[model samples]
Target: MIKTIIFDFGDVFINLDKPATLRELSQLGDFQFNNSIQDLNNQYEVGKITTEEFIRSYHNLLPQATEQQLIEAWNAILLDFPKYRLDFVKHLAATGDYKLILLSNTNELHINWIKQHISFYEEFKSCFDSFYLSHEIQYRKPNSDIFEFVLQEHQIQPTETLFVDDTKENTDAAQKLGVHIWNNNPKADDVIDLFTSKSDLF
Candidate 1:
């Protein structure tokens, strides 16, 4: 039985337009969504660099865009955090039957935007027993170490936890450690359906 739940933030609770930023950037230069970009993204998410430095990389690469334009382009991917999902998680958290954790691969800029735009950001956050942000924690998902860190920190048994993520690679990594998982399809699935869809686990 699952006594603990680890959820990925983007696509799991908050929606993301994963390609929006890339598409917007492509307009300014010959940007190949290649290793260089991925490397930079990884560094930013893990808090290896400051948000200014992260923004400067884009400004340097796409010289035509100003800092404001770059910041806007970078934040285009974030969308709304539906109220119903917030309600569902809050109710689940209130039950106190399962340990609730939110693990997200995100950077300061995105978080800052959420805090500014989402009115209930703090309230939503209070529901989690533990909240791990990649930038703050210096760890990102799809990496075995991050999953291991969470397990060790919470003193949780892998077999007794359920991890829900929108990405297959992330879920695959967690499953290797014996954690049951839901690789939620963002296009068709909603986090609000967690109880009904994964009823057997509950």
Candidate 2:
């Protein structure tokens, strides 16, 4: 039986404009986002570098951009958390039917922005039995080790868990480790479709 539910935060619950930062940064100056920047992002998400250093890395590239401007552009990717999703998750958590866990590859700036804007963040967070944010955990998804860490830490069986993520790469990684996953398309499917979509497993 599926006893645990692992969820990815962005696009799954919270909305994100993944390209918003690139657009905002372009407006500031000639900022090129290539493979190197993606590496820095991976490092930043896992708390390998400090927030100041993360911004400075961008600042170093686009020296013309001020710290405030860089910070604004960096945070543009994070959008709002909707109310209905919160309600749905809360109801699921209240049922005590399964162990709910949140696993997200998120950085400090995005999280801070959400806290500042979303008043009910704490309440929504409380619904999860285990909340794992990449920055705090020092590990990010699409890496097998991170998935192993969560499974080992919680003594969760991969076969009995359902991992929901909007990103295919992330889901693919988890599936390799024996976890059943729903590579949920944010455009067509919502996390609220949990029981109905994966009814057999439930």
Best of the candidates, lDDT: 2
Worst 10 residues of 2 by lDDT: 73-82
* Local accuracy of candidate 2 as per-residue lDDT tens digits, 76-148: 8988788999999999999999999999998899889889999999999999999999999998989999999
Q: Identify the runs in model 2 with alpha carbons over 4 angstroms from their true place.
A: none
lDDT of 1 at 200: 91
RMSD (Cα, Å) of candidate 2?
Answer: 0.8
Clashing pairs in 2: none
Report the error of model 1 at residue 174, Å: 0.2
Regions of model 1 farther than 4 Å from truth: none
> What is candidate 1's lDDT per residue for 1-202, written digit by digit as tens?
8999999999989999998999988887777788998899899999999998998888888988888878888899999999999999999999999999999998999999999999999999999999999999999999999999999999999999999999999999999999999999999999888878899987
